[model samples]
Target: MKKTFQYVDYLWDEAKAAELGDDQVALFLYRSNILGADLRITNYGGGNTSCKTIEKDPLTNEEVEVMWVKGSGGDIGTLTRKGIAGLYTERLRNLKNVYGGLEDEDRMVGLFNHCIYDLDSKAPSIDTPLHGLLPFKHIDHLHPDALIAVAAAKDSEQVTKEIWGDTMGWVPWQRPGFDLGLQLEKCLNENPGIRGIVLGSHGLFTWGDTSYECYVNSLEVIEMASEYIEKKIKENGEVFGGQKIEALPAEERKEKAAELMPLLRGLASSENQMIGHFTDSDTVLQYINSNDLERLAPMGTSCPDHFLRTKIQPLILTLDPSDEVIDTEATLKKLEPSFEQYREEYLQYYENHKHANSPAMRDPNPVIIIYPGVGMFSFAKNKQTTRVASEFYVNAINVMRGAEAISEYTSLPRQEAFDIEYWLLEEAKLQRMPAEKPLSRKVAIVTGAAGGIGKAIADKLVAEGANVVLTDISQENLEEALATYKRDEAAIALCDVTKEESIEKAYKEANLAFGGVDIVVHSAGLAISKSLPDTTLKDWELLQNVLVKGQFLMAQKGVEIMRKQGLGGDIVNIASKNGLVSGPNNVGYGTAKAAQQHMTRLLAAELGGDHIRVNTVNPDGVIVGSKIWEGDWAEGRAKAHGIKVEDLPAHYAKRNLLNEIILPEDIANGVFACVGILEKSTGNTINVDGGMANAFVR
Candidate 1:
């Protein structure tokens, strides 16, 4: 029978390949990029490609064989020439004569530097020897789901023989170092015509005399394995034991995920604050809702790259997404103990596998969390890292599915997982990473952020390493505002603060995008100027709804997400000096500002136990770049003060104690202080009014 799914295809473009002519490095990069473009062939940063090129040596001025391989931390899909490390092939081959055997692998890494042919090439990865030792002109090492299925299966060796016979080879699990390189060379010598080798419970290696041949050989093997697995899956007739629990409705699953992510983020951040990413795609939903999920999930992932980023295992939450009775409070209470237990088990695993000189146990928290009928959440120090972890785990799930369809799936043994996780090489990599920014893992939401003070606040927060969700009532403004930022640094959510549904939806957007909120700024407000006689019930209600009620709704929803995250948070309310000083023709706007100020104090006192600080920034006049001063409000204030609308800026500046102008940027600076600097203070007011005697907090 014909299959419903597709298989990997040959993407080698002859026209484009011919354009490069005989540039071996360009051809090497081309083959690697096409292989990586389709994730079904290999995961991002999971595979490497290399080629032997004849280049003139600077010292000898003679053509010599040099190997260019993908270096440490380079993703093949995005690989450039700069990402390739070039080394003398003769030097690498010579190291075998002075080989120190299995115990001396770590020392070999430093020795590769002496083999460098160029001073500006990238830092070579540990896999350098695997490519250097082989005599082939071109080589590719990929973690394709299809080949890894054969590699991870219980009968992995037998499957390798069944799929390709003597044409491909097999070797049991070995750490990637000098010894493993020797084993691959040994495999090739024994099987002279072999075109590839399968690393048991690891990945695949294929090579050819030229780059095009290498590209086709890799694709051919992956396509063959994919067809073999698809055939067996058809014969077996069921997957994951036929899915015991049906998935929740897509929207309901999204809603449940929004509820759970914040709580999970809080639990995962016990050691260090973490950012989060969530996904409910069909791939994850299929596994988590399966009858075999309980049995298979504990088997964990079989590949090293998968587990290194996702951890040795993932945590499965008890609350099913399809549960009819959703008692949110009870669900929250029950999650605490589960997270605690997962942490305990992680510590126990570390203890069970530690070497005498193993690096200290790392954050004993789960990087990936799953729930039946819903989806998975992955957390890390930043959004991109969190997203990558999630992607790696999904790759792991596919590897398990392919392995299980034909034969039982097996994870790397505990000791092997530990060895790779705590290797001295990995410790050095971490030490080389640059120090993190102060707000590295923080997520913030700024209301009315499309313009004026809110826009400035959002800009400042992003500059300081915070991921911000910019929300405003106008969709046009919201889209325009977020255009200035990278997708990972900022996002837009359409919000109307006066409407509860709008506020709830926006908060949920924040939860799904960047984990949870650590800082909340309510800068969405409107202003009006009216004398006691002219201020009608309609004008008072309008001002109250926008200034007072808007701030209240934002705080109410923000505190809910912040509390779920369990980390302390800051809430900065953009109030004004009109609240503290009595002024003519300001009856409606002044009273509303007063209410917003008091609400800040009340919430600060109430949420103190939760460590959620509430503060206020009162700017006397921010008319220069303010959206509030654009229309009727500017005219009303100018008419009452006996000044032209254009002169209001000078008028306000001269009246202040400092006789200096205050702009929206000044208001934003005050907000940064409340959230970033004034960590010890709450329920306090910082006046950005350039000094007004009556408006002083004291």
Candidate 2:
């Protein structure tokens, strides 16, 4: 029987992190899941996960020692303490620096001798030796699609040099057990104080002092690789159109999908799920039926990391697999010789290129194969594996198809691939490390940043080390926002959000000033109280333009810039608490604000594939440094309620369970949380409104 896997829904928003008992754990899981799905870093059971904690043990009655890594075979999506096998630091370190040469099997057995497995079901993760080599408190490792795409290429070494430069140390892939650990030891020693490591033909390794830090760094580094590959693919690809596979009837498609699953399962092992991604995307469909697919079949993957799922080559689909044209019987006939030929070629290549210590030989069944007009297949041991394989294949197919229009889609030669495949030192180094903030290389653009929530979010992002572009409709307010921060880390942009032309001009100026924009903060909004009956068309329009249209335009233009640069950015919309929960008699204002939250989700859904994260922050009647605090609005509300504005602050503060007043910093903190200042969050509206809506924000 064939089994199918579907995408899992996990929280990846900043505000949502507050709900988790341990934010760092939540962050790690979110990042690990993304990387797992990405196809560059991890495929099936290829990577490992770990986190460090300073906890008091009941038996010892003191703080306990060491980190806990996810036990082997546990999915990254729902990892828990039981899934983590605790490994003492001293034991792991001792295993890494062992000087004597030993057989690969001996080393593997020796490494496992240290692990004291608690549960009968739990086995220590395969990358235990690699984990012991990193110095960070928390770490994550994955064979990300983009990183693998580059690493698995024939000219991977040269490609890595051109793409990553000296920032990340690249190690050639070695067999995944003990020897790889030794290789990482040498690379880490050479690149003192390096943040992360990229394993050629393998995946990526990143770390930070905290889980959030490590997770964000993983996102950042892989994103860099993804961006590089996307550009190269775009520049070099030709638009070889594909056929419409989705047009097949549901029953027929399902049966076809079922038939293909066993072949994929045979290659991936029965433990894995062979996910089917029959896309409506023109590019994918077109590539499935392209006339050039046969010629390009031997071209292999866009990158090598996909090998875990895709293998080095895929079965090309130049004809339909329907009963009329091609049946399973005929499919088997075609695949038998092809499989034999592939095995012979692979074995000969390995025999000729073998080094002293190399990875154990596996089967030569194609991990990926084309199915004519129907689509493609990626064989993996499980759902995570299948998902990653699907992603990699789609990206590669897209790149290859696109590049076909412009140039020949050639990969690096077999010798280079063999070098990465057999490189001892490189495999040893692919361990998890702590994540860092995502804003290190980013330039953020913030509007309506004249010292309220905008200033607060900007300041927090800067503290986490992002270069901020703080903008406001008011020049004085913009100056005020600038005055509160270091001049170099932050800049000021002046523009009214209501005018599309002004919005365009401001973005252009910000880009010119900062070189590019990787994140956006829309804090510019209008606040006026009037019953729906009393509201004028002008008032409604003004509110709509500033609060709603402002964000839309910013996102639309911001996405364009981010997409072109290959740096998928984040957008934080400053909506109001009224948007989500019930509030006063202002109709236009509430509607506009509510619309902002939905817009955030829309953008996130639309641009997620492009690597952009979009979210909203709703503050409840905040009193952060603004004219509203001192002006008629505050006094009028105070008088209407028969209380002084001074007293209103205390009254509101005491309303929440925390009994804390929502400051500009609080709202700002919400914004920073969205910009990957913290590792987990998106498509959420954080309430900085003194716990106004118990039903909504926590």
Candidate 3:
């Protein structure tokens, strides 16, 4: 770690701090940014900073000493004034006198709530007492990988003495709580003139009267540890036999991930509901492909901080690097049994530690999966959690490697890890999460998702908490569409629906991304208006290839994967009003859509034995945001109605009995109703045309 403080930026922040009226908050924000900006110092949401200041109580009209700590659940990198919780310091310190010694963690939280200086302030961090008990005006706590590397070694105390001499204090492993706060206070009283304290198997804490002092103290300590590790590596050989192994090309690795990820996603999932994210970054690949991976990967988390995100041990799967190509089916056969074995081991671990009132064991599945020669696969209940687990595991790899360079890397004993894993403070966070949406844990595929109706369907599915795979013939449009929604929950695939190879590849990629598909919305179609006498063979063939043949291929492939998983699924085909009630110059488009509508009925009948439901959404006059109804198509429709092109929308709206202008969102609503709200009603057609009597089938 190099020093990242810039003199000019510091001066600018100082000047800006004076204008904010609260110098402590402004300085805290600045220093927190500087600390969080360096990944070497902290990973995502892993560190905290605080400042002690004075504020006037609105009700009392008197100045009160307060501690403004980083709020719980806020990331330090993007912290704002609202992200700091203000508490009455004198009152908060007085809680120790009234401590009943019952439900300490819960009582600590309640007492912190009672001591808030501002009623509207956010919740205080659980580690607030750790800062309040210290005498300094500013405090910094971080899980710097370098510090953890030194602190987690077998001879951690000796390493600490060598690196910091008498300037730092060492506290043994203790779960963060009121008790830990008391322990820290005792340590500070015993070790005079110490600049900071290193919490064994946890993190680093430093404090000062000014923000600059606290920030610089943390930097210097971490820098010293980094230098020590670097020297040890130079004296000894590379950590864990750091021999460079040749990796497959990037494209080949990506292909291998695509092939293997689906099987892992299926096997690692608890009840086939978990979503997976694959990562093959150079650092992760370097560690997983190393010769010592079998021994090192199973050695537990570098620190207890990660136990909440990642379990104690990662599941290791050995791969045959000699086989150049991946056979997905054969791989699944091997992984299926291994997944069962992992679950059994995990249950046994839980049984060994369970007491009368331990929290229910979190799904008995591994959060991190190590695939030798491939990379890492991180699994979670959703996409964001999966990404977080991946980040922590990456940091774990670095910390462990650094420790191996100096001494053998050892983690907290398994019992200590289990205690933290079941700690009520951590479990409460999960309990407070919002209820999942209707389609949570389900995966969907939306064809022709570049724009208009297809894009609308994808957005709606994501809003209801489904992982969607958006496919279109145009890559640019597909990417733009994905960017509009939750990007993590949506993926893009450039697919030409007219080709069998393209359709197959798209489904395979979707399976790799989110295990398998549970819903298919076939919205990719083309509308070409031509009279019977004027229609050519090429126009007819084009319509059939995309509108009719494409749906067949998509349904066939989607149902195959759904059947293999034995999960009931839904398929909705986007047809047209012209299919049921034909107008002049609608020979090609109408015939193809009519065939598609019949195909939906046939599929519903044939697949009902497997509990698969198929339906059709026939929407007419969806002129707004419709790419298919623009340019010549709009002009032609206007000509048929004896009106100007711009007035065609008004004319069509008036044509319906309800006189309502149908939008793409209206069509999306119908599709959503079919797949989600109307779960029991399938093998039916729902028309979204604002009551077109002529096209009514009932």
Q: How much does each candidate deviate from the true structure in C-alpha RMSD?
A: 3.1, 18.7, 3.2
Best by lDDT: 1
> How many residue-pair clashes does candidate 1 contain?
0
Task: For candidate 3, write residues 1-698 as lDDT tens digits.
Answer: 23454211122254655665557788888888868777777766787889988788788999888898888877776788888898988888888887766356667777799889876677887888888888789999898887888778878888898889999999887877777777788889999889999888778999888877787777778877888888898998655676445567777766776666656666666564777777888878878877777787767885766767878889887566445334556666767777888899889989998767789987888889877666788888777777778888887887887788879788878777887788777678778878988888778999999999999998899998889999999998887887787547899888888898898889878866776788999999777876788788998999999999999999998887776555678999999998999688788889999999999999999999888899999999888898888666676667656789888788889999899999989888998898889978778999999989989988
Clashes by residue pair, model 3 = none
Cα displacement (angstroms), candidate 2, residue 86, comes to 1.0
> What lDDT does model 1 reach?
0.89
Native-referenced Cα lDDT, model 3: 0.81
Q: Which portions of model 1 show Cα errors greater than 4 Å? A: 1-5, 9-22, 208-213, 322-329, 530-536, 620-625, 637-665, 689-694
Per-model TM-score on C-alpha atoms: 0.92, 0.46, 0.91
Cα error, residue 656 of model 3, in Å, equals: 2.6
Candidate 1, residue 246: Cα displacement in angstroms equals: 1.6
The models' CA-based lDDT, in order, is 0.89, 0.63, 0.81
Query: What residue pairs are clashing in model 1?
Result: none
Global fold similarity of model 2 (TM-score): 0.46
